[model samples]
Target: MISTHLRLSALSLAMLAATPFAHAQTQTPRQSGDGAYLLETVEVQSSADASRDGLSQPFAGGQVAEGGQVGILGTQAVMDTPYSFTSYTELLIEDQQAASVGEILLNDPAVRVARGFGNYQQVYIVRGLPVFSDDMTYNGLYGLLPRQYLSSSFIERVQVFRGANTFLKGAAPGGSGLGGAVNVVPKRAPNDPMTQLTVGGQTGGHGHAAADIARRTDDGRFGIRLNAARRSGDMAIEGESSALSMAHIGVDYRGDALRVSADLGYQDHRVDGGQPNITIDGGVPIPDAPDATKSIGQSWTYSDSEDLFGTLRAEYDFASNVTGWAAFGARTSDESSIFANPTVTNVNGDYTASRFDTAREDTVVTGETGVRVRFDTGGIDHTVSLSGSVYDLESKNAYAFGAPAFSGNIYSPAPVALAPNTVPGGNLSDPGRTIHTYFQSVALADQLKMLDERLLVTLGVRYQRLKDYNYDYNTGNRDTNFSYDEDALTPTVGILYKLTPTVSMYANYIEGLQKGARAGNTAANVGQTLDPYETKQSELGVKYDGGRLGGSVAVYRSRKPVAGQDANNIFKIVDHQKNTGLELMAYGQITPTMTVLGGISFLDADVDGDKAIGAPETQANVNLEYRVPQWQDVTFDGRVIYTSSQYADAGNQQKVDAWTRLDLGARYLVPLANGTLLTLRGRVENVTGEDYWASSGGYPNAGYLTVGAPRTLLLSATFDF
Candidate 1:
């Protein structure tokens, strides 16, 4: 029998001991108009409005640090936005040592993690919704896909808008705007000649480096930014490790009327990791042995991937209240993998294949142009924006294997075959194909104000057309041919009433839809692109702001008027779903020396009016930091996260119990004689080392499991020049 009480690892012990002595620094405060000082630190809860230069501006929950708002990409403001939204800045990203968007989102209670094809990719589940960025829009145009295996090293900030804002973005269905969209703002010109270098070592001899240099004019008009990171080491878990390199360069010009920016970046990762699944005997969850072995049918594999992407954007303001812009972007990825199946067992009680190989190649290109016009109408300000774009994608997936099954069972251990080769006469190149999708959108919006600007009303409508074409493929020889044409007209409305200069309440109703060709029944009872997916969402929330603290709370419900579903009761292409949630978040400086960002969320998702499988009912995050004046420049941070129990399978028989985790981190700032600053930080994850499952079994009657990352420690240092 496995012991339920797991001891903390050596790494965890080190972090726990050092955390109490770390230095904490208070953030600089910038004044807001209403007798308030905005803490310039992190972007947590704030009005997400793109019109505001796309940078984080402190409002509710926490300070929207300027650096955390707009980067090389774009901006999303919470208040200026029509839906539920949040964002994180580069400083926050650095503090958490998050490697990708997926890592960052795990801190958000409302967001969930979807399976990733590779460690470098992102598979975010927001409010039970999946986010995919289609139409490569790097600087405002086309971007790359996750399968291309990109990293966040070059990203300056990340923004997310929950619910539908399709009116603001065309072809919202194909992009991250589905439940919401994530915009990675790139880095721009720095005002001063600045340079930074970071070096770190974690468990398993892991080492990492990050370097950045920037220069900008005092007037905040022109600048250049360059950043890069390289990491290599064995991962905390045995059989899991890798090496990676990434770089990003950007040049920008910004003024009262004109702004232009361009960014070029690339990332490559050589990985050797497998899915970590747990085995449960009876009602007790199994634990990994000291030698690092997991459940059967599990995977232990190695993968390598390289990604490249770049973007160019130009914007001009024709008038004081009007502006227009054009942008273009290109991205590509090459991924290859080899792996062994650990969980599989044959009828004769033998293991599965020794190894197999797979590869994916994908590319995306995008172009776009848009204009924003603002005018006064009857004492109210009205803003209207219109945009259009064209995007193309080429994706190829192929596999070759050399192994034999021990028996009829696919999961059974099998010995190597005499030769490793593609199946005889297999169409190895058949997966190579091109997909071209064209999208156009036009939006008209107006904001009406009354009662001395205390009462606000906003209304807008958008018309969109989407066309997907399968080009450059031999139709007769193709195993999969995808083509589609669809259009949608979405509407958005919102109202806000200011109880006072420091408090306000707002409500919004919006609509979302996804249209494309459908694939089901495999030609037997196939259905033509079913009616476009329709999601109607409504939210009511309030904002509160004081001199030193601010935050917001909201409850929302989004329903798909009609959906497709299967009998198993899980959400799939045919499964219909309804999701509702309540969210509360707060962030700010409780005092000159204390900063906090935290939130809690309760969610309910039903498929066909029944509880959706794997949809947890509650989740929360609480991150607190204190900067003591005595320790000047030192900070101590602690985070508490909790997730309620949820079903693991469609039948609900397999369930993942509720779990909570504690993490402690700290940073110390040391000043060098040359005015250079050295920042040292360390973190302990999963202080309790809780053994929990993340995912359940898939397909057939066989069982599978997903395990949470075990306790690990990381230490790093950064030098500023």
Candidate 2:
């Protein structure tokens, strides 16, 4: 471990030394007429804007925002906050032609995308921990978006918060996000009236179209926006096809002291013969990855999902120094799926597969209210906030397994007869209540600024309660003995100090909370519920904003308790998994015609003196965009992603090889005689067509391999009037 740490440190130092650092032109802070400091500010049309707290302006390169939300504390400038975060803007999304939230997050070196166990839901790994898609919040409220997939047409900003954030935001309802959190901001009408249409196609006969329209009243107090899109056809992988439809409407009212906004969305998505993750059987050697374009899934398998959701938010200003806000959201979703993921039993790629079918229904309602007050005591400035939130989720589910397993070869798979479900649980058509979860929390925070606003300190705490219940899948009888009701207090402390006009240093200590697991029937303490687990993190970092070029370097350490049964067969918290890492990020223009965005992360993760499964030692990403001075309307961009080798199992005997991928894109804009604008874009992913395993192990203690996407081409055209 010592030698590995030293090696990583050396690599980080070398990269930093090779990077070009530009000196920022010093400038004095603007001041009001009353001689009070006036920090940088962005004009927000209304409190119902993208972030609800006011959308942060884009940075120098127009790819990332200058700042983003700090949970209940509201928005703060990147240089002023004592935490690490990045907000991707709509401009970047459009330029990249990203179709999903996971695609947009690829630019972050600290994040890696994976698939959920036995499903196609997108999962994110941040700092060696998994954050489920359902755990993501929409407009500060949870469980309002589609559980398995989300469309990008309605998204205006994607905010990523790094490190433990239970104190900033309440504990995620899905029991994930121990390392980080992601929040999506919905789109709203802009100041100008607009109509846009887009059409696109990809390499596998897939086609798509979308429409966006927005308008505002004469007084600019009432606004409405509508977005709709559809896509259908085969994907890059052979034998796999998908169809998706989505519609969303956003309405808002901006008043003198009261602001109100509402959004409604609907989505229907289906996939046939989707590729599945490969699981390696114990004692079997990890086989080489198969051809990227090959599909081992049975053609009879399919997954279908439909969802309807909405949110209402209002903000009122009681006074100039006091503000209050409330938000409510609800969602109803249904999913049905038949899966045939195979388990490799030998080095030659021979595998055993069985048919599994499931149906699920979910109903969720969540809300939050908060008040913020600003005041001053002597020479110290203070901002205090008090907030409360509640979330409830009821899920009904049923499943069945086929009679016998089938055998196949990974190298060459052949279609088999559709298997019949024999072993059943509950009712497949109607299902039954299997799980219910309720979460409630209240938090308080205060921020103090001293030394002429050069030094800032923040302290916060949250009291959270989690109630969970489970029922027998077949009988639908409540499992009273296994139910859990628990609570915990999570707290945070952060400090930031400005060393110069454009340089700031910050440190933070925070905790993340999650519901504990109940002992299994085989354990000596069966049916016993353990206390909630709190994951703790400590971090220190320095940031530099050069106006044109900016960057940051941070070091952090975190520990999370691991639970298991001891030799006596009593289940308990036995050990703690520790992760220490260094992250370096750089973004903004590198020259007059060149812009760069990307970063690298080095991590050392272990549990019980052994390497943690699926934790990589190094990950890096670099994206560069350049405009041709000769052809002023044309721009080109490219990106490279790299990940180091990782262990796939607890014993550290099975290792998934490291991999790298490259993507390139270009776009052109044309001005027409009718005063309309037309833009065309083209992108190529996996330019080298290298076949490899993209990720290993998304679920806890499980080792599954996700095949990398094949080389593919994407093209799109947009018209604006």
Q: Which candidate is the best by lDDT?
A: 2
- Give lDDT tens digits, candidate 1, residues 568-602: 53223555467888888776778767877778888
Off by over 4 Å in 2: 1-47, 50-53
lDDT of 1: 0.59
Question: Model 1, poorest ten-residue lDDT window?
Answer: 15-24
Cα lDDT, all candidates? 0.59, 0.85
Candidate 2 is scored at a TM of: 0.93
Q: Which candidate is the best by TM-score?
A: 2
| Every model's TM-score | 0.81, 0.93
lDDT of 1 at 176: 40
